[model samples]
Target: MQAQAFAPRLIAWQALNGRHDLPWQVNDPYRVWLSEIMLQQTQVSSVLEYYPRFVTRFPDVQQLAAAPQEEVLALWSGLGYYSRARNLHRAARMVVDAFGGRFPETREALETLPGVGRSTAAAIAAFAFNARETILDGNVKRVLTRVFGVEGWPGERNVEKALWTLAESLLPEDAASMPAYTQALMDLGATCCTRVRPACTRCPFAADCVAHQQARTAELPAARPKKVQPTRYATLLLACHGGRVLLERRPPAGVWGGLMSLPELPAGELSEAWLAQLGTGEVLPAWPEFVHVFTHFKLVITPQPVEVDALAPRAADDTRQWLTPEAAIEAGVPTPVRRLLEALSSGTLSVSHQIST
Candidate 1:
């Protein structure tokens, strides 16, 4: 199939079938960029819940740029991928400072923003400026690899380069249709050519799709090779005094960056030492071990509660705080940590009712 022929059919199909009413599909670059960043490694359904709230709160680039990072992270608490929130804040500031509070119309300028890669930059250019640029996000990659039967894992450099070339070649000459064309590719993959159980019968490209013809729709876009995710252990100190739990702000990088969490004792360190470091207290019975999985590793968390007469003193520069369970829940703690706090606040946990001497 000629690369030129792909867009017309996609555009026509999108006219009737593509998503036209997503919250961020409007002509605003701020909304488009926000949606794109939130959609990274996240699903449309999930993004839908967060997008409108974010837009209502921030509304525009200038407002988002000026909002405090804690406020932004609080709004983004359950969205996962903490770095996206951080980068979105940084990028908004950059746009305000460097571009005078306007998103750059060109892909090149957009790409310079934090977390805006080539594909994301291209998306903003097409949707916001109607620029004739190609996007090769995961959905597009799946759709193209199946239609064109490009083999090998899309994560590989060579495989990705080939897909990029294919993506660029398929761009329609008429720049006016760029938004529809780009959206068509995304919708086709998301709704029709899905990762599992693709509805090929409903796919617009099924007739000429090489993977369909060869009955290899399941095989063309190779999966990433699997490796065992390593497990790590940590003990979190749930120091409580006057109904408040001790929370520490993690550094603004790495896992759960910039989020408030329970104080952590070093791996393999005794709970006694952490308790002594704070004040005299007895360790409560441990909560059931819980696991939090990251992209590359699994964290086995042991939460130990300590009842203290007074919270430990902190240096003037410390990020630690003692907030009531209600307050901690409102803070930007991760999902699992939030669950623990909620349990404590609700008195559903046995340990919270009984203070160990």
Candidate 2:
């Protein structure tokens, strides 16, 4: 049988038995878009709880557009990659202002919005607008590269272009089923043609997979190039006054921005006088050391505990808030910051000052 004709049947098999009941699965594009954004650099299990809450808060494009940036950022707290939240907020406003509070009707228009990349745009276009297009997310990329036995690492200019072209070529033109078909491919790639291990026996595309036929399934897509990651050091100041902990909101540009976090690196170096100003007492020596890894860098954080009568301007640009341990947790701090706060509150961790080296 020709590959072209068999493709839909393969996907149909997947649709009937493959696609899981994702939170945004129904015909609601706003929910779909929300889930897709949260799913970036995050997992299904992680996204599950966040997705429903996001939709409940925003519900539609108009609601998201009208929301305050802080509220949006707060809703997006745990999901890292703060820029995605910012962009989603920006895009929502744009959609409301430019598109009459409606999600763009087509992939091209959707792509013009902030944070909506090609695959994301394609998804919105298909699942939302029922456009006949294919989406090549990471899962789809792996599945396509392995099934067709395409070569070269992903993102290589020619290889990526070829993948996109192949993706377009495989998409069924029938508008009625295009949306389901697109999602079906994603479902198959995520569930069956998985990264660590593939379930060939259950995969509908197995019979026609070129790599599988040749016993080269694992070797089809060339391994990606790797580079060494650099490490950086930072200082975090933990302050407590009368059962309240000091938490500062990060600026909206870098990592964990807009989330409530520890007062960090208030100045070039901590001084005894500077410590006396943040709360009711004096600055103590740096005590605990913690290491955390982000996507691009490893951070070694040295925590300093300071007590003062009233929180002051630790630096030219720092604002301080005092809250109970439970209140701080509800204030949108990321995992690392929240974890540290929890440890401090539970007496499992203690406060001190600067690591000499």
Candidate 3:
């Protein structure tokens, strides 16, 4: 393969066919970085809805850094992977404190910031600084694997190292072409070289692609080894009083970390201490059980709705709050917690005093 010839072809194809109208296509590093973080494991359609709203709220690094973590989590409520939001907040503060509110220009310098890995730094540098950096994101990995007919799971350390070396070797020599070339690789992978049912006929490299030529597109870029994801269980206390539900802030690190959620208990059981602490309350019939899947395990949640007359003064403190069901849904709650709140607000999961007895 002629390494020098690849960039020009990709650049030309990008000019005519690549995405240009994305909201974050500009030269601003802040917007580029924000879009990249949000785009991680999330679809463009979802980012499109979120990016504008997030930017409008925070506007810049300074604004984001100045905002409270709760506000940040609230804005990122529905977006899975809450840690990204936490890291983004930390990175924003670092940009303000360490870089004097301006993003570092070089990829190496950008990597010092939290959550900015090698590929992410490369993308930020290429897009914002026009630096000649190479990115090997999932899309690019797929494209390279198929184009070169590279075997083995891309997640393997050796395979990833080879892909990185290959990616760096393919970098466009002229720094001026960095943005277009980088975008071209991404656009090609996203639009034409899709994981399933690739549009090989429309691909610029279709004629020369090894996988296309050998009819082994499906076989190359081996899938990750599968394992059975284990399941866990927890019970959420949906204590309601005066049209408000109780919520507790999660610890700083773990599953759904730093987000507000329903107070949890051991599955299939309730704590007598919690009942006594919430003053006189009737533990109504438990709501339907549901499952919230994480990357590592499945969380089977049983929501126990309780109608309390009044809360003890200590029950609702800094760690916990009583907010209207609608307001609680608007808070920094997880998706599953949000669903439960919505159900409570809409009377979809109601329990009467009669139902309790």
Q: Positional deviation of 75 in candidate 3, in angstroms? A: 0.9
RMSD of each: 15.2, 14.8, 15.2
Which lDDT tens digits does candidate 1 get at residues 73-131? 99999999999999999999999999888899999989999999999999999999999
For candidate 2, the lDDT comes to 0.78
Candidates' TM-scores?
0.64, 0.62, 0.64
In the predicted model 3, the residue pairs found to clash are: none
User: Which stretches of candidate 2 lie above 4 Å from their native place?
Assistant: 1-3, 228-357
The C-alpha lDDT values of all candidates are 0.87, 0.78, 0.89
Report residue 280 deviation for candidate 2 (angstroms).
Answer: 62
Q: Which candidate comes out best when scored by lDDT?
A: 3
Candidate 3 wrongly placed segments (more than 4 Å): 228-357
lDDT of 1 at 179: 89
Q: In angstroms, how far off is 275's CA in candidate 1? A: 44
